[model samples]
Target: KRVGEDLNRHVTTDGSKAEWDAQDVGLMNQVNFDESTMPIPLCSCTGVPRQCYKWGNGGWQSSCCTTTLSLYPLPQMPNKRHARMGGRKMSGSVFTRLLSRLAADGHDLSIPLDLKNYWAKHGTNRYITIK
Candidate 1:
């Protein structure tokens, strides 16, 4: 059975921090007519022609088309999280797993992620919320 008064209460989505207008949204969808080059400031590409990408791997990489970067490791989890992968991290593929289950409420960890209780009992600005 479903539980908790918090779960029963209605909640609205938080205000967007970007607060983009129509013009700002359109800026992202602009068509690039030139295949040989991209516009300045918008693209700092050094990798491929006709690429509209901004910067690659903090400006050190050639293009977004190729990547040698590995993302930071996943949040702490219980044992056997990646049993099939032999304890090695799955890199950027956390969401790429085809399995039906991936994460949990984190109530049992040193850093619990129960969201509701994740914790009013502990603190704010947790790792998951960081950019």
Candidate 2:
């Protein structure tokens, strides 16, 4: 059974120092796009004549044909949210596994050097000391 009132109930609108200041706290808005009207760019190619020659007052004849190309920007893919985190909480087991994997991948799990030194010097245990 839930012990306390919903956390949302405690939220206050009064802009005060003591009150919890909650701003920009909500699910990320989804991106909207109009698919039908959006134009998809196309690629096109054309052939051009090179080295034209005139023979006996006849129309010029082309020796070789050069290819002309037109390239257009690709259309943007519709944005999609893979997973929605609304009102969902991560279990402790999942959190532990994530942290363990991160640590195995060389992520730092040690305390800061300055804090470690301070604790070594002034902490309750006398045996601990920084080398």
Candidate 3:
């Protein structure tokens, strides 16, 4: 019931409870068959060594590495009005340089490529493509 409660209460905007309730039906549209599991990927920072894995079978697994949370938040996206309001195109060199800097700073870059081999070895999200 905790997960359900989290889904119901924590998943939506603060003042739109009724709207959330009506739309929450869509959340169940993608229910899975066999359970899937993901260990929180290892921290890519050179000094930190481990992280915890939340398993599908209802257990927490731990390791020595630490994780670096992205400056960008998950689920929530940048506002559309704010997205390119700075007068920059998506593929501009400034954006490319920023991404490269972020990658060098240890941001994971693999999410776009959809590669599993890199993930299998280092865990999820330690390398990302800046280009």
Candidate 4:
């Protein structure tokens, strides 16, 4: 029940734009190491060194080492289509989360740092906006 044909897609970073396959094809696993368990970027979450919790009013709170279910959507189904869409989005988000962490950590040392040196870099830049 897959829809249209897959097309080559790419997002320009820095200044260069290269073609990339739309499908993941298990690339994340190939690139991931033993320390790549964390999925979420910010806000306390499991797989990382932070703990999070959901509040009664509808917000996330940090605990110590608890697995917080904040903002995580339960599996919903009206039909197969909805489920497929949800799964696709979730997987896509996870892939993005991994890429972001890798990029931030400068683990893929092939690309040169644009604005600052990777050796002296630490922590997330809150003001940095990605196109």
For each candidate, how many residue pairs have backbone atoms clashing (under 3 Å)?
A: 0, 0, 10, 0
Write model 2 residue lDDT over 55-128, tens digit each, in one string: 12222211221122112221222342332111112233322333344344564544211111011111111111
- The model with the greater TM-score, 1 or 4, is 4
- Model 4 per-residue lDDT tens digits across residues 1-131: 24764443323444221312333435444443222454322332233333233322322223321121323332333454333111111133333434545555566534321211111112211121111
TM-score of each: 0.15, 0.18, 0.18, 0.20
Model 3 residue 116 CA deviation in Å: 26
Which candidate would rank higher by lDDT, 2 or 4?
4
User: After superposing candidate 1, which stretches have Cα over 4 Å from the reference?
Assistant: 1-18, 21-33, 39-131
Global lDDT for candidate 4? 0.30
Candidate 1, residue 85: lDDT:
13
Candidate 4 TM-score over all chains jointly: 0.20
Error of 4 at 109 (Å): 13
lDDT tens digits by residue: candidate 3, 1-131: 75445555556675353552353323233222122332233322233434433333432222222132222112222443212111101222222333344355575544221111122222342221111
Model 3, C-alpha of 73: deviation from truth (Å): 22
Report how far off residue 95 is in candidate 2 (Å).
0.6
Q: What is residue 21's positional error in candidate 4, in angstroms?
A: 9.3
